[model samples]
Target: MKIAIIGTGYVGIVSGTCFSEFGHEVVCIDKDAAKVAALCQGQIPIYEPGLADMVAKNMTGGRLHFTTELSEAVPEADAVFIAVGTPSSRRGDGYADLSYLYQAAKDLAPHLTGYTVVVDKSTVPVGTARQVARVISETNPTADFDMASNPEFLREGAAINDFMRPDRVVIGVENEKAATVLREIYNALYLIETPIVITGIETAELIKYAANAFLAVKISFINEMANICEAVGADAIALAKGIGLDGRIGKKFLHPGPGYGGSCFPKDTVALLRTVQEHGVSARIVEAAVEVNAAQKARMVKKIRDALGGSETGLTIGVLGLTFKPETDDMRESPALTILPALIEKGAKVVAHDPQGMREAAKLLPDSVIYVENPYEVCLGADAIILMTEWNQYRALDFKRVLATMNKPVFVDLRNVYEPNKMRAIGFEYHGNGRGHEKR
Candidate 1:
């Protein structure tokens, strides 16, 4: 199948490249000429675990292409996918700003030459497919195309494996014609007995939000549990393991951290709330999840402050990671953003290090925070050390060397990477989330 993906961002580029790997000719189109140029030179815009290598391989194999102009690929393709951004409307609001998706629909509408399936590959609202259909129909009344909704379920770090061998392939199609084309496009997966769920458009759209919201609820529930564990002298890890071994509640997003973030849960939960409100329905569980997530982040700030002996004023703190999670350089809504800024505002000087997030973090974090190349360098002259994001490097740090470099041996493990008893044996005052701490 000849595929044209109308956005070269994370979802678009990864989906397009993976499609090409399935022996389908795919062209990823983006409005940003600089990004397109970089991709053409085998330079990836974002850092995913194995995306660059896969993109480079597929491009070399002459199956994947990148371009800035939509006109160059849209009319020649059998399917066109809209994979643009739909960020939150504002900081506090959860409404999805669908301007980009609508623009993609409008831009590609005029170039629809024949029977083509215009698929919604973005994590859009329930009626977004209908809106895209309306926009395309209003723009080009004579064009014949079928609209399908195919939401992606790719985790950021392990997106490649998720795409190659997914749990299921969902396609919301109105007719057999559209469904057949989508199935043929996913022929490789279909051959491997991947369950292709064909449903109505709205059900497919709702599935993505439902899945994300449920996971968000689970994460918030555990974080809330962690708070309970902290207050009651219990351990979150043991608690999680005890319940996660159950076949029903399988352990996936059970690790309680600085709340859920990074391009999916936060936005999707908010969007789901907005959608529920629009329909005049109650989403109390999701609303509580959102509230718990915010409270968790604030609680982390309080934890750090208390660990500093009541105040963060005039202290040098070492921060381990900046990205939301490990193996990815995405800092959007990272816990460090909230914690560091609050501490900096309270007059604490911070030195931070991450394997890949420093460049992006520097743009968002305040100037009071110093970024260094080496993780241990962040520990130099530090009063306390914070393991913010659990990157691989921070997990196996030499505690003796770390203690030698720091001014005061205050180890605050927000990710709970190291055990409290072990840190005590090593002679450092360690603080862990949800672990019974002797000190503040």
Candidate 2:
């Protein structure tokens, strides 16, 4: 299979590299010459676990290539994947911005030589595949291509494994030819008997949005439960465990935290809501989840302020993590973005550290935050320590050193990574979410 992927963002780069690893010839195209050059030299722009090594191996094996020109790879390709970004609209309408995606289709129209399958690998709204097809046909009426929808479900920090061992593959096509090409591209997964759901193009597009919205709802539901546990003098961890043990409600997104924040959940949930409302349907449950998620982050600010003796004014607070979750450096919609700024506005001096997100975090966070080189350095002379993201290093911190270094030994565990009883025994004032009954 010869695959040409447009856009070198997270989805495009990962999908293209993984396709090459499957023994398919792949060329990832980006308009940015510098990014293409960096990729060609084995210099990856993003920090995904094991991605750089895989890319290097495939490139060295003559299976993967990167270029800024579409003509370099599009003409002879069996399938051209549009994996560009579909970020939330800047107009505040909660719709996905599809200008980049549509432009990619127009650009690839003239280069289509034979019966090529044009696959939409980006998470997009319903009917986007049809719109892309219309755009390509309008641009080049003589082009021979079929539109297909193959949305990606890659979780950041675990994208490689998710691509290779996906729970299932959902492909949308109008005819057998397009379906056959996509299936052949994923023949490796087919050989392993990976379940593939072939559906209409619209259903495939809606599936991605529905799946993300449901996960967001689950996360918001757990956070709401955590709040109830705090109010009723119960433990959310035990509560989650009790309910999760039920065969019907397995334990996946039930872990309580500040809120759900990442590229997918926040953006996709709003997009889903927008799409539903646009169709004259109501999505009240998803709407409430969005409201609750916003409130959860605000509540975390209050939780920290309460732990700081009713105020954050003039206090030095240490944050252990900045990225939304660990193992990736994506700060888009991270709770730290909201929580830290609110605390800073209340006159708190903030210090933060993340294993891989400091460079990116510095760009999104307020300039007042002091970025530290070491994890423990964030605790130096701080009034309190807030365990924001559960990075591996923060899990087993030298509490003795932290207790000694802090001006006030106030520990606020937002992620509930530590036991409330054990932290209290460690001679520091501890505050954990949904563990009101654990206070001694």
RMSD of each: 1.3, 0.8
Instruction: Please estimate how well model 2 matches the true structure, expressed as its whole-model Cα lDDT.
Output: 0.94
Count of backbone clashes, every candidate in sequence: 0, 0
Residue 196 displacement (Å), model 2: 0.6
lDDT of 2 by residue, 1-440 (tens): 99999999999999999999999999999999989989999999999999999999999999999999999999999999999999999999999999999999999999999889999999999989999999999999999999999999999999999999999999999999999999999999999999999999999999999999899999999999999999888999999999999889889999999999999999999999898888999999999999999999999999999889899999999999999999999999999999999999999999999999999999988899999999899999999999999999898888988899999989999999998778878888999888868653
Candidate number achieving the greatest lDDT relative to the actual structure: 2
RMSD of 2: 0.8
Cα lDDT listed for each candidate = 0.91, 0.94
Reference-based TM-score of each model: 0.98, 0.99
Give the distance in Å from residue 190's predicted Cα in candidate 1 to where it truly belongs: 1.5
Candidate 2 ranges beyond 4 A from true positions: none
